[model samples]
Structures are given as structure tokens and as C-alpha cells.
Target chain A: MVWALALASLALVSPARQAGVMRGGAAAPSFVNAAVARAPRDGAPRVHMASCAKLTEAAALLDSVDVFIFDCDGVIWKGDSLIEGVPAVLDMLRKAGKRIFFVTNNSTKSRKGYVGKFTSLGLSVEPEEIFSSSFAAAAYMEQIKFKASGKKVYVVGEVGIQEELDLIGVPHIGGPADAGAQIELKNGGMVHHDPDVGAVIVGFDRYINYYKIQYAQLCINENPGCLFVATNLDAVTHLTDAQEWAGNGAMVGAIKGCTKREPVLVGKPSPLMIDYIVDKYKIASRNRICMVGDRLDTDILFGRDNGLRTCLTLSGVTTEAKLLSQENQIAPDYYVGSIAEFAGAGVKA
Target chain B: MVWALALASLALVSPARQAGVMRGGAAAPSFVNAAVARAPRDGAPRVHMASCAKLTEAAALLDSVDVFIFDCDGVIWKGDSLIEGVPAVLDMLRKAGKRIFFVTNNSTKSRKGYVGKFTSLGLSVEPEEIFSSSFAAAAYMEQIKFKASGKKVYVVGEVGIQEELDLIGVPHIGGPADAGAQIELKNGGMVHHDPDVGAVIVGFDRYINYYKIQYAQLCINENPGCLFVATNLDAVTHLTDAQEWAGNGAMVGAIKGCTKREPVLVGKPSPLMIDYIVDKYKIASRNRICMVGDRLDTDILFGRDNGLRTCLTLSGVTTEAKLLSQENQIAPDYYVGSIAEFAGAGVKA
Candidate 1:
């Protein structure tokens, strides 16, 4: 009964049903390119939002999906604390035979750390159940069989990236050192660099400055063969409803400008993060998967690009006006005010 | 006379004099455009270096100019210390009726501060004798009569820019605060903003961080009419032979990426800095002025752009190989091993 209700929620919004766009199976196209994602796909408008405000409308969409992917910062939690009713809604999803995974562009945390946070918040989580940009970067390096055996990693980020690298036995430098160990410049002098640094990884670095970036250039600019990788390309991090923070993209962009090159960004919308998840956890069907988040381009667009359904939550970012905006090309299959809307309302007994 | 010998130096390298290109008078062109600077102007090859290395050859080139504009960092001093034989050469120029003005893109010091430095380096300089990028920015603001009455300037630079603003009584905020007074980010939280921040000036700040850049975005992005200005676009600040520090351009570029705008750059290669000088000094003939420096693009290209004859010295950033390289579109009228070569060694007593 609950499955039928969930199908109704999805049917209320999905353009796939209207235009017969859900050409599932082997015929489902691979990732859509930028040009295709810009305009409507399969004769459907490029963007859409759920029409019903009732919990049952959104719950029907949730019940149809077997796996749920979430963006952390603006969706599940505000900052260090968990969002209200998020745990209960997640618990209900789990009881209904759903696979849950947390995908974040916040390159500041490792997957293990995210799992720990989930456990602390009274939600069950396995290490594989969370995918962070940091881990995505780590996994990417592993997949490529990165030849950083003897060379050190020059990091322009926090400790989260370092932890992931260490797990894979990668040596890194230039991250957050002990307190008061900040490098001082003599007027306009360059920082001393290590000759063995073969790769440069940039994430969310709070202490980013002239010396760190100059050192990164010394590695990449000096050596043309060096690897230039960044965790995410988020423009800004929405902290709360009224406040925002500069994301890892700013630091990454600065270095890119200095070196006159672009980095391989390993976050949402890249397909690298989601690709790693799908390859590891074999889901039943692509249409039965959903990504829920508070942003458009990174979350909903990422879902649309990868042939997965998406739900937009208004509890954090992407206000209703923004969702309905004509300027937005990113669209989702279902919508809810918060995950709290799904708690104890439409789930089966 | 020294004038005849100096003309000989110009005769040695002057495509202008050789090819009858010295078509001076009111008929000479105004400022050269960016595309013109990128390629050879007036059927001239893209790049030319001064041929004579002897002091007599350099002095011959020097004698043709009355006002000589010198770039300080590489042309005069290596860092805090003066280049070998610089003070004596400057003195010789002053005695030869040459109006010696030190024009530095180093936004690290104000004009008065430069005077102190010149005095300490055994070279006498009045405040009018030195034109720094800091003073140029201040002068430009004054020219526009920035109506910042009861408004504060958001400074994302060091003391040099602040000092110039203070001299003009333009109240500013966000420079070197007390030591250990760095602002920390609470995830995506916002910093309190000033209601009266009318402009944002960017320079090299050692203490730049997330909070600082975010605060900058708030001022520029939130206020559509705010002025965004930068000192220079130098990719790296030359400190020593093998070292370089990050320049103001990196900081400016980040804010540009965030706000999707460009800042009005007020340094070398930008006619604004030199325009202020030409207007203030009221020089008679454009051909009577010679811009002398160590770098090609910033100093030599700057000279070419402003209709001034240019000279290059090998005391700093541009190596002889780089100067002679065909990749360079910037050409100079004369070149020497050092400005010291133009002292009494080659000039008439």
C-alpha cells in the first residue's frame, strides 16, 4: 500500500511518465553532457517542482525509491548539529527496505567521520553508506593507481583529506600544522618547497594564503607532469538560512589562476562521486534511486545528469521561488519542506 | 656634451631614429591599446633588446631623456637592500638635469614611506619624486572624488594602501588588525558587515582567509554600486633570484570569480598610474620622457603603451635570454647591465 502511495508521489511530478521519457534498462542513456542538461530532455521542460504540499504526496515519491542519496550541509544538518526529524525520517526509510547514502561536496570531512556523525545523531550508518568529496578524491586516486609512492602530496586543505590519504598510505604536506606553525613571509618572499612533491590536492583550507598557493605553483608549474586535483568546485557553502561561507572552490580557483590550468574536480555533478557509489553498491533499478538536497546545480542537476530521480527540500536552501524560477535548469522529481514531513505520516505499519 | 653621447645610445638601438620612426610632436599617437601592446607596433617587430652593454652605450641612451621613470624593486633594489651602484647612478642622473622619479608597482609602500627608504639608501628623494601604486590608487580615487564622506573603505590589503587612504583622510577598515586577531569561520556563518563600506581595495595581505574574502563578497555583491579596485595584476612578487611571493592579482582574481566582476587595476601597464604623473608634472614633450626598469611587460610594455621611450636594465626579473626571446612583444629603446652603468662612468663630468 505504501509502495503504491510512493509511486503516486513520483507520478505527480515526473516528466518521465508524461513524455514516456523513462526508457529504462540498457537503453537508459549515460551521463548527459552540459549542453543537453541545459535544455529540456525528452521534450520535457528543463526544470520542475512538486505541486502538492501534503506529506503523502512527497512520501509516495520516497516509497517508490529503494535508495536515497542526500547532500549533507544544507539538507540533513545545518552545521555540527543534525536537522530536526531528519533521524526519524531516515529511520523510517531504512525500515522500508531502502538503501541510504550521504553524498556531500564538503571536502572537509572523510566518509568515516561522516559515519561517526550519523551514529552520534542516533542514525545507523556503515562506512560505505557515506560518500564525501574527500573520499571520492581518495577513491579516484586508488582507481587510477596513482604513482605517489615516493612523492609527497601538497595539500591546500584541512585534515579530512589528509585522513583519507593516510588510509591509502599516501604521504602529504602543507595542511593544517600544529597551532602557531603558520608560515611567515619576509615581506614578499616565497615559502620553502619540497622537491619530492609530485601531486597537489586542494580542498577546504581555512588557512589558505600567499605562501601555500605559491608553494602549490612551485610543484605544479615547475613540474608539468604533476597531478593537479581538487576535491570540489562549490562556489559558496550555505551555512544557514542567512549566512554563507567561501567554499573550497575559491582556494582551488586561486591556484588554478596562478598555474593557468584547471583541476580534476571530484565532487557532486562530476559523476565521479556517484559513479563510485553505483559501481560499489549494485542497486535494483536506476529509476528507483533518488537524490535529495537543498541546492540545484550540484544536487538536483547531478541526479538528472546521472539518470536518477531527485527530490528538493526547502528546509535549508533553494527557496520555493528559486525552485520555480525560470532561470534554473536543474529540476527534481519530488519536493518537500523538510525530511521531517515524511516522519510517522505515510510509512506503512 | 653627455646629450650627444646619450643620443648615440638611442641611435644604437632606436628603430625610431634609424627608420625615421621618431615622428614626434603632437602627431604621435595617444595610449596604445592592449592588442597593439601584444604585437609589434608601427611595423616594428614584436620585441627588441638594447644591444650595447657598455656604460657609454647606456649613458648615450640616458642623455636623450629629461624625466626618467624607474621601477624600484628589480631596477633599484633586490629587496630591502639597494642594487650595486644604484644610489650613485641616481645622483648622477639628478645632477645631469634629469628629473628622476622612482615609479614602483610595489604596492607595499606609500610615497612618504618611499622617501624614507630612499633617504636610508643614501639617495635623496622628496615625496613628489616617488610615485608608488598605493599613491596612484589614492590619487585615482581623489580624481573621481569618491564621495566616501562618512563612509569607510573595505581594505583587503596591507598598511601601504591604508597609509595612503589615511593621508587623504579616507576612513578605512580591515587591514592588519592586532596580532592573533584572525577571524574564524563557523561553517557557513556570515561576518557582520559595515553599512557604509563604499569601496573595496585589494592588495597583498598576509592574513587573508575565508572570513576576509566572504566579508569582501558581502560588500561587493550585496552593494551593486560599490567600487572594486586592485593595485596590480602581477602574478608573483619577485623577492629574490629564486623566490617569489603571491601578488595582489591572486586575491583580486578570487573576488572576481565570486562576484563575477573585474577590478579597476591601478599599476604598471595600466595607463592610470602614469597618466596621473604626466598630468601632475606637466611635462612638455613625450619624447623627452624615458621609462626605465628591469622587467619587460610591466616596465617596457608600460613605456610602449604610454608613448614614452623605454629602457631596460638587467638588474632584476627579466633575464637577458627572456629579453631577447621572440615570444616577448615588448621592446625597449635602450638596455644596460644596471642603472649604475649610467652614473659617472659613461657620462661626461
Candidate 2:
């Protein structure tokens, strides 16, 4: 039952609420008050909810926004396959002079890696138009002027985080290289810690091992002024459409258990990525930006918590029945069968 | 702060209280009420606590016990080297006609493995006198008639567990073999699970990796009636005198994070080990049994929760300062600088 409550809070609660409940000492972002004020609280009437599948409604939704932030996995594609009509819808939005940005919580790939993915999916995208959680983590360190601290980062993630840190010229250790490490109990389980590790960044790591978990915990728990950062806490992730694999949350949980510390989440619903986007791109108005995605928890919650209008598409994890369930706390502004409806709306118009 | 509270509870709280707090649905063992009735409650004056280092008190303690249960790692030895006067203390206890049993929460080694270590330390001990958590796990399975269910076990531990399971003729899979297994995201992160795995057993593992964690989670979360069992939840363990390594709790935490399930603990303070020991050995009258150890949480709490007299040593993880701290909740009936004090007491006599 506690797990259920945790899951519910993770999936439906706003980032501010999550910050208060999960990360005890984290301060809510400045933009949270405005977003909280605009969204309907639990037990409130659902009068603002609408279906944007119809041509008139969809076109009205499209016309209201100058910028569109899309979640990649479920919105534009699932796994390696592109979603139907996504490219056409993107072209139409571009023709209408709408700026587009691909925002993803997937930290397994960097911005350049995502460019390769986008190109392979037949979508033209620039590195600047992508904001992965890996990029957010790197940008956060730069924002805090971490390089001047004269301490390195201890990574418990994959190549994406390593590449992003490399891009920013931030020194780090212990990622894929530590995957094959084995604790030799015969020689005595004396694990050495690097005292210069001032921060630990955890993300989705397929090669996660006990050595990395122990090393990261040592840095976070023992190093002075050390930071614990999580790229995302998504409980499960889609590496393929076949099934959900254990997400980075599992990796983070291991260290959290050992160190007994809460990580500063830099992924979706944390406002870190969106704030970075807003400051970097100098986005004029939050009211003119719309977030389109297929997940109620990460994508929709991220949008709602950052003062952006949100549209829920049923092409990925969430479904219409789930959205309409009595216990559902999150209410998206608009719902469609898929993002393909946008192309249909253009054609009808 | 929560971790501190959890640690305090783990080390000091009686099993009944731990059951009520941590394992919500489980019922306290029949011996719990008597144990709770005998121990001093928090906020009460610890009047029964005594220093057994004096010859008078030590001789009185030695005179009252019919059986002695000693915690291995911290009590008899730390890693490899035996503590000073341990052999003489054991010889004295044996000559006094006191039955001795070596009870350990270290699931990394089975009873047979312990015999070799004891012999190497120049102490003669029979396998029947050892009660490792690995043996308790196997015994528990037999007690519950798990074999009749025609289901195999999935192990997330080392060879100790495997050896114990083999002794019981229980079929199992996934241990050292799964250590090197990698998740091939290139082939789609679709991990197949064996439908026959009806239980998962976790313990301190050096070669812990993502594949074992993911597989165990799948079995516990998806498979029908799949049981999750943990050998122990010790936060930190000593492999040598150098420093503490992350214990089995970290390994269990990874799976717990993903599965959101509580495990049936089979180690110290769980009553499972003591219950099995009592049942198999036909030990009568718990009143005369003395539990001697260096740790307060597992060893002393195990004794207190099982209605046995408890003695704490300052030779391992716990110190006298901690025992006398204002925040201390659990109180052992007797305290000593080390078991070597027993030898001093004998010499004085």
C-alpha cells in the first residue's frame, strides 16, 4: 500500500508536491506557484478538460501555441519505429512557424546520439532542439560552476551521461569502466573511495553493478559537500515496444538505500530541464508553449508543473480509460488518439 | 534522519515491534509477547543492565546459562584473525558444561564452510553446532512444505545459499552464473523469465549485477505467488578491519525499489533462524540460553526478541559510548569490554 501511494504520487502529483514529499530539502522552482494556480486541484471539477481529436479543436489548440515541446519515445515513435503521421504533423507545425523542441527523460543517450535517432526516424532535428536529462545534468553542473570546486563527479550511469559531462569539460569517473569490477572478498572487501569525488550522478545504466553502487554511495555519504543527482526516476522504461525494463529509478534506489540520501532529480517533472530550456533559448512566454506527450506521469506532469499547456496522446503508456478513472489525479488540457490527429486536423483545415 | 530511525529500530527494537512497523502483515512469533514483557521499554530506567567484567558478575552469568549462542563475525573473530582469549573462553564454557552454538547472520557461508573457518582458527567445532542464515533459509522452506508446491527457487546470492539448497534437495537457478549476464538493449530489453520460479532468495553478493536484479524483480512482481526472501538487512558489514562495505541491504534495496515488495527476512532478529534452531535441536527452556555478541541490532536484539539473556561486547561495531547514549533504546542484560573478559574472570577466580 505504501508502494501504491508512492507510485500514485510519482505518476500524478505536481513537481512541487513531489519535491515536498520525496526530496525533503529541495526548494520548489519559482514558476511552480503560477503552474499550481492554473491547474485544477484534486476534487475540482473537470470543466477545463477537452478532446482535441476534432479538426476545429485540434486546429484551435495548434494556433494557440508558438512552441511545441514533444516527448520522443511515445509521441514521435515507440522504440525504433516512428509513430504514424508524426513527420507530417511536424512539417505542418514548422510551416506554421512554430518552433519545436524534443524533450526526453531518457538519459541513456546524449543530444548528439538523439540527433542520430531523430535522423534515422526521418525527422530533421538539430542538437540545440533536443533537451535530454543527460544534457540537463551537465547544464546543471555548469550552472552551479562545479568545475571550480576542484572535485570530480562519480558517475553511476551509462555513456550518455559520460558524453554530456565530456561536452562540458567536467571530469568524472566510474561508469561503464566499473561494470566488470568484482569485489574480491578473499582479499578482504576493502573498497577504496576517491576523496576528490564531490558529486554522484545516477541514470539508466544497463551495466549497473554492486561496485558502482558502493562507490557512488561512498562519494555521496562520505565526501564533504557531495551531491547526489538522478537524471530521472521513471520506474519503468521502454527500450523496445515488447516490454518495460527496470528504469533508472531502480539504480538510484540502490544507492539511496545504502547512503540513505535523496537525490536531486534533474529529469522530467523536476523543472530542471524546462528551466534550462527557458533560460537558454530565451522563450518569450510560457503561455505560448505547449507540451505534447503520451505519458500522464512524466510528460504531462512535467508540462503542468512548468506552466505549459499539455496535450495527452494515447499512443504510448497511458490510455483513455486510465485518464478517465475516478482515482486519476492528473487532468490534461486535451486528449487525442495519437499525435497523428494533428496531421488529420491540418488536412481537414 | 529516516535512515537513522530505521537503523535504530533495526538495532534496538524487538522483533514484535519490527514486525509491527516494517512487516505490516506478518504476525509476531509466539515467543514475542514473553520477550517484550521481559525487556525494559524505552524511557524506563535500565536497572537490569550490568557490567559482567568483574569476576563475581562474570561467574554469576556463566553459572546461569545452560546454552550459549554466539554471533560469529564480530564475536569469535573479525574477518580472519581470532580475537584474543576467544579460544580460552570457549574452552572454559565447554568445561563448565554449557552447550555452545555458533549463530551467524552471514549468509555468504554455509554451515560446512563455517566448520573449515573454525578449524583454521584452531577451534574445534562440529557442523551441527553452527546455525548460519543460509541453513535457516533452507530449513524454513522445508518447514513451509515449499517442496510440495513443485516450484523452483531463484537465487540472487552466492554458493553458500546454493550449497544449503542442494543439501535440502531443492532445485534452484540463477546465482554465480547470472553474475556476468548483461542486458542486450540492442536485441530489445525483453528479458525472459522462467514461469517455474516460485521464490527469490537474496543475500550478500559480491558479483551483484543488473541482470540478476531485473530478473528477480520480474519474478517477484509478475509471477504468481512468488515469494521475496532476504537473508539479512544489515546496512554495513565488515569483510576486513579496513572499512565497511555496503551490505546485502543494498542488493535487496535494488529489487525492493523496482518490485515494491517486502521480503520475508530469514536472518537475525527475524525469529526464523532461532525458531529453526530450537525446533531441530529440541532446545528446552529459553530462559537458560545466553546470546553473546558484539552487535546490538542483530545479536542482542535477536536474543531479546527470542526471550534469551543478552550480553554485548565492545569488540566490533558497537562501542560503550553507543550503549550509554541517551538515544539508545535496546539494552543488553550484561556488557563486557570483550569476551576476553570471561578469560580474565576465570583467571581471577
Candidate 3:
């Protein structure tokens, strides 16, 4: 009986049904009108405006979406502890036949690693349902035919980037192994650049040191046609809920400063991950997809720039004042107190 | 007899004598006319043009200077081996009674350490005559009355910064000790920042690691009114004469990325070092001081920006093609094949 009810809910939120409701504005839900009224029209100058979807309009907003993409950190959980009602809301979305994807700019984890994290958090997730920045980096390299170049990639990151590159059959060097490496300047030691290194990928690395930075810069600045790639440029990352630590941007900036060159960003707000998802999953319509995240710059801007509906959650890095601040140029289409508001219970706010 | 000849040479190149020559343009040496003709006039559009001081005119150029400031690394020596004729040039300059100061942006060594390098290189140098960036950082802190606040500084650099701070009686922490420190994310490790830190100094450090980057960023971002100071932002440095390695800019860039803050630069291209030198040594005139270096951006730009005569040498990181390129905006007053040409021997070029 539960399966039957789930099937019925799935049919009700089908992509075709959602597309029909979107095109026929007269038949659209009240929340659609509320969101569309504040959103900029096509070809119009984009203004930062978002509607606070009330408890009564929450169901209507969720009913209008056929696909849902979520940012893992801050949205799903803060560090190791999962946010309240996350499991229930995820289960509810699954039952409603909403296609879900876990997208994260945290390049410290691979898709398989994310699956493990999700499982440990008491949420069921498959590797295919997750798209980490590390995976995006690998996918980008694959798209560029880097594997055919027969040259190894110089990594200034962690094991996650190495694993992703290994998955794609692209050889790499200089990751966590360089954590203890020292440049004996007292003994007149020098870092030698490998001629076979064709690319350097930077990510959040706890083991980042001067040696890795020197190697990455040497490859990027000296090697011919060497590509400099960054998994993400997040200013700070949540190692734990207690404090924010230096993010991948710190590592990438070191190389950027030395090389005086910018890297090819392949994380959120770049449109590369969404493009990869669209091609791989055959996503029908962008209008029927909703991107739920915590950050305005990375998550909300990522969705808005990719023509997807965006919902901002206040349970993460952003606060209510920050969301409503005039300095915030990128606004979402709708906002809720948290993703916990979608638990089907009465809205907490 | 040597003292009498030195006194005579000193009177011949006195400030007043050089000033008279400058005012009496028609009677000035040929090299002076050559330099003035190519140099941009006082209110004219500045163009990148530098005349190669011929072998015949080297003596006249040397005689026109009351004070000589030399950059150590590429201008004086490559690594351990001193450049040919460096000692002879120093002897000749001293015999000519010119005030000489060894100004270096390499923050890896303190003034005392520089004296040791000079002694080992078979050159006579006093600690008071050397103005390293490390000393400049300490001087800057002293000028800002940082010690009165009773707050300690957090260092993300080598022992040079520490030694200078020690010389100034300022408290500091986190240098080579943090090099072995690791952030064990798997064990849920966190970096605890000290609350007593009022400033963070970044410089060229072979021991630079993510722990230092994180601690520095936390102090700069979370601590109120904390200062971010950089010894230098040199893109690259000569660990040896063979190749260029990452400089302090790489370490500074990491903290800047995470904190999103600009550092108070105390090294070359910043007037802090020259200002400290002027205040301490009481330099009479900027025009009578010749700043000799190899790099156009840091050394030449530093001299030019400070109203001192600039001379570029070709023995360091910069090539003649780079100096003459259309994109090069900062030009020296004169160019030479190398500092070796100033040895009073015939110019090799």
C-alpha cells in the first residue's frame, strides 16, 4: 500500500506534469506566482529579490519541482552531525519521486567517499547520485582528453583528487605524500620540476606546504601548455561546526600568487558540474529542477547562473541578515528557515 | 696615502659637487646627458626607456653618486659563490668614499645574518649598513607602537622574522615549530588559534605549511584589529643561481586568500624599507643615491618609485628582452650587462 501511494505521488510530480503546470501560468500553484513575481524576467536586468515561502506555500513549491539538487555541507549536515529532519525530508523527497543529486564544492571527498559519508549519516546514497568537486575535476579532464596526453598531473591537494584522477586512468603525483617533504635551503637544496607534468590541480589540503606550492608553480609557470586547475576556491571550510578553517582557495591562491596566473575553476558557480549532470542524466528541463543550498555565492549563484530555480536555506553559513543585506547581489527564488521545514510536519518557522 | 686619496675622491663626488654638475647641464658628463635624454621629463608621459651605460661612461656614472645601495642576491652574488669583481667593486666604492648600504628583500636572513654572509663572501660589511626586509618588518612594528599593546605576534615565516622580532623585544610564536604540525581531519582535529596574537607576519619560509596558514588566517580574520604583515611579496626567489623558486608571496597569498585581507607590505616596492633607511641613516638626497638591482619590478620599481636613481643589472631573474618589451612600464634610469661592469675594468658587453 505504501509503494502504491509512492507511485501515485511519483506520477503526480512527473517531469511532463511539472512542465505543463509551468507553461500554463493560470494553472500554476500560488507559490509559483509568488516566486515569478519577484524574479527577473528573461532579458531583464537581474535584481536581487527573493520570496520567503510561507508554511502554507511550502507544499506548493515542492510540488512544482521534478528534480532537486542539494549541496552537501551546511545544507545536509554541518561537519559530522546531520541536521534535524534531513533524513526524513530526503526520504519524503524520494517517495515523491523527485530525482535528487548531492552536489558539493568540497573537493576533499570523492563521490565514493561522499557515499560513505551519507551512509554513515544514516542516509542512503549511491555514488551515481553524488557529484563532488573532485569528480567534476576528473570529468573536466576527461572532457578535455587529458588522458590521451600521456603526461601525469601534478596534484597539490589530498587523496580525494588523486583517487578521482586514478579512476579516470590519469596518472598523478605530489599529494599527501609531500606532507613531510622539506626543501633543505640550508643545504642548498632545490625543487626540480618534472617535465612530464602537463597539469596542476589544487584543492583543500591539510598537508599543503612550501614544497608542494613550489612544485605546482614550477609546473604551471615553466611547463609548456601546462594547465592550472582548481577544484574549488572556497574561502573557508567547515572542518567542524565549531570553527571555519582555511579552504582550497588558500592553497590555490598560493600557486596563483607565485605563477601570476589564474586557474580553470571547476566547482560550484562554474556551470561545469551542472553541464556534466545534464549531459549524463539527460535532465529534461532546467525550469523543473530546484537547487537547494546554503551559500549565496557558490550555491544560489550556481543555480541562478545555470537557469535553475534556487532555494536558500539559513541553516548554514548565511544568516537572515546576510540574505537580506543589500550587498548580497545574488538572491534565490525562494528561501526557507532551513531544509528541515520540508519535513511534511508543521513549518518550524 | 690611501686615506688622503680616499678623502680626495670623497670631495670629488660630494653631494654639492654632483648637484653642481646636475644644474650645469651643458658641462655634465656624456653619460648624464645620455640618461637624461632618454628619461621622461618631470610632467611628461612616462615611457619605458633605459640607456645601456657604456664601459667608457661607467666611471662618470659612479662619480656622480654620493650613496650606493646594492641588492644582494643577483647584484652582489648568485648563491654562495660571489659574483666576479664584487669584492673589487666594493673596495673601489669604499675607496671612492661613497656611503654604501646593502638593502635586501630576502626576509630569510636578519641583519646580523647578512653580516655573516658578507663576511663569508670576503667583503667588509657592518650590521648597521645592512637593511634587510626582516629588519624592516621589525622597524615597521616598532614605528606602529605594536609593542606597547602587550600582544604577541604570530609568525608564518622562518627564523629571520623571529630574530628581527627578538632584536626588537617583541613576542612571537609559530615559525619552524608549526612546520611539523598536522591537521588530522580523520581524527576530527582542529587548529586552535591563540587569542593573544595581535599581528601575523608572513615571509619566505621553507617550513611554511597548512597549519601555519590556518593559524595565520584565523588570527587575521577572527581576531579583532589584527594586522596582516608581509615581509615581501616577491613572486620568485633564487635559492640557487640555477632556477627561480617560490617566494614569500606564495605564503602571503595563502593567508590573503582565506582572510580576504591585504597585508601591510614592508619589503621592496614599498617605501617602508627606504623610509626606515632614510630616517636611520639620514640620507641627504635621493638623487645622489643609486639603487642597483637586477629585477625590474621590485628593485628598479622600488628605486624609481622612491625618487632614487635606478640601475638594472642582467645577472638575475630579468632578461634584457623583458626590460625592453612593450609591456614593460617600469624602467630603470640605466642598464648594465652586470654589476661586474662597475669593477672599473672594461665592460664585458
Error of 3 at B331 (Å): 1.7
Worst 10 residues of 3 chain B by lDDT: B47-56
Candidate 1: residue B74 lDDT (0-100):
84
Cα lDDT tens digits for candidate 2, B1-349: 3224534555664544343232111132221211222244566543322212112246656665689899987789988878888999999888878789999888888899999999999999999999988888888888888888899999998888999998988899998989788776653557898999999999888788878988897798779999998888776667776666677778777777777688898889898877777777788877678888887878988887887777788888787878766456666766777788777446434
Candidate 3 - CAPRI tier?
A: acceptable
Clashing pairs in 1: A5-A60, A6-A60, B5-B60, B6-B60
Scoring only chain A, what TM-score does candidate 2 earn? 0.84
Q: Positional deviation of B136 in candidate 1, in angstroms?
A: 2.5
CAPRI level of candidate 2: acceptable
DockQ of 1: 0.25
Provide all candidates' interface root-mean-square deviations.
3.2, 2.0, 2.1
Name the candidate that leads on TM-score.
3
Chain A vs native chain A, TM-score per candidate: 0.81, 0.84, 0.85
Model 1: per-residue Cα lDDT at residue A302 = 79
Please give, for residues B1-349, the per-residue lDDT of candidate 3 as tens digits: 3233423433444353334334324344465444323344466555322223323357767766888899988889887768887887788778778789988889988899999989988898999899899998999999999999999999888788899999889999998888788776643567889998999999888787878888998899888999999998988887876668888889888988888899999999899988877777788788888889988889987886677777888888888888765455555667777877777632221
B118: Cα error in model 2, Å: 2.2
Candidate 1, residues A1-349: lDDT per residue as tens digits? 3233434544564353322234321222331211112233465534322221223344456556788898988888876667888878887887777788889988777877877777776777888888898998888888877744578788888878889999998888888862234555465545677888878998877677766877887888776578889887776775544566666767876777667678988888888977777877876566777888888778876776676777788877578877655455444655678878767544543
Runs in model 2 lying further than 4 Å from the true structure: A1-57, A63-67, A187-189, A279-291, A294-297, A304-312, A318-337, B1-57, B64-66, B187-189, B278-290, B300-309, B319-335, B347-349
Q: Every model's Cα RMSD, please?
A: 9.5, 8.5, 10.3
User: All models: lDDT?
Assistant: 0.70, 0.77, 0.79
